[model samples]
Target: MTIKEKEEEVIEEFSFFEDWMAKYEYIIDLGKNLNGYPPEQKTPENIIKGCQSQVWLHAYMDGEKLIYKADSDALISKGLISLLVGVLSDQTPADILSNKLKFIEEIGLNEHLSPNRSNGLSSMIKTMKAYAIAFSK
Candidate 1:
């Protein structure tokens, strides 16, 4: 699916939850399902800055697409990255760069997250886009 389609899927999934608590639980579950990050790849260079929690993100180009692997010391942060990864992974760099990921606000994630977590989420997006920018060249 296209990035926009994937984002809409996320928005639809979040719409199933009747309350924010349920949505939060869903996010946690999504984190739990994330593919394991290789310990060796969790280097300082992979670490996302400006986050209260330690979030490590590694990206590599596969063919013309960028693939991302990420982990966070905090559960909520992990889930947030997992959400981003699900939407943005295995896509072309141009697509990743152009997409604004409006699903973040559409799903009410921005309002529900703590300020620190919100900043962390932005860092994750920035890191992912940076990877895309590098691969686009």
Candidate 2:
């Protein structure tokens, strides 16, 4: 599926939750289902700066698309990254760079998060876009 399609799917899925608590449970499930990053790739370079918890993100170009792998020590953070990767991965670098990731706001993810986690989410988005920018060049 395209990025927009994936994002819409996530938005629809989140819409089913009756409250933030249920939404959080859904997010935690996403984290648990994440295809974890390799131990070897958790280098300093892969570690995302500005996040309170350790988050390692790695990306490479696949033909014209970008493929991402990531892990976070925190469950919520892991789920957040997995959500992002699910929506943004396997897309062209230009597409990723141009995306604003409105799903976060659409699903009320940012509002429900703690300040630190909110910042970490932003950091993850920045890191992903930076990778896209670099790879697009």
Candidate 3:
């Protein structure tokens, strides 16, 4: 699916939970389901800055598409990256660069996250976009 479609699907999924507690549970579940990351890829270069917990993100191009792999020491941070990876992976660099990722706001993630987590989320997005920029060249 396209990034927008994947994002909309996430938004719809989040809408089912009536409370933040349930939503947080779902996020943790999503984190649990993330594919295993390679130990070798957990280098300092892969670590996202400005996060309270260590978040490692790696990306590679599969032909014209970018595939992302990520892991975090913290549960919520892991889940947050999982959401981004689920939506942005397997997409072209241009597509990743162009999309604004409005679903983050739509799902109330921005409002619900703590200040540190929120900044971490922004760093994740920035790092993802930076990868896109590099790969697009």
Per-model lDDT: 0.90, 0.91, 0.94
Number of the top lDDT candidate: 3
Task: After the best TM-score superposition of candidate 3, give how far the Cα of residue 125 lies from its true spot, in angstroms.
Answer: 0.3
Off by over 4 Å in 1: none
Q: Mark the 10 consecutive residues where model 3 has the least summed lDDT.
A: 29-38
- Number of the candidate with higher lDDT, 1 or 3: 3
> Which ten residues in a row are the worst by lDDT in model 2?
94-103
Q: What would you estimate as the lDDT of candidate 2?
A: 0.91
Which regions of candidate 2 fall more than 4 Å away from where they truly are? none
Deviation (Å) of 65 in candidate 2: 0.9
In order of listing, the candidates' clash counts read 0, 0, 0
Task: List the candidates ranked by lDDT, beginning with the highest.
Answer: 3, 2, 1
Can you give the lDDT of residue 3 in candidate 3?
90
- TM-scores, one per candidate: 0.96, 0.96, 0.98
How far off is residue 42 in model 2, in Å? 0.7
Candidate 3: tens digits of C-alpha lDDT, residues 32-57: 88877989999999999999999999
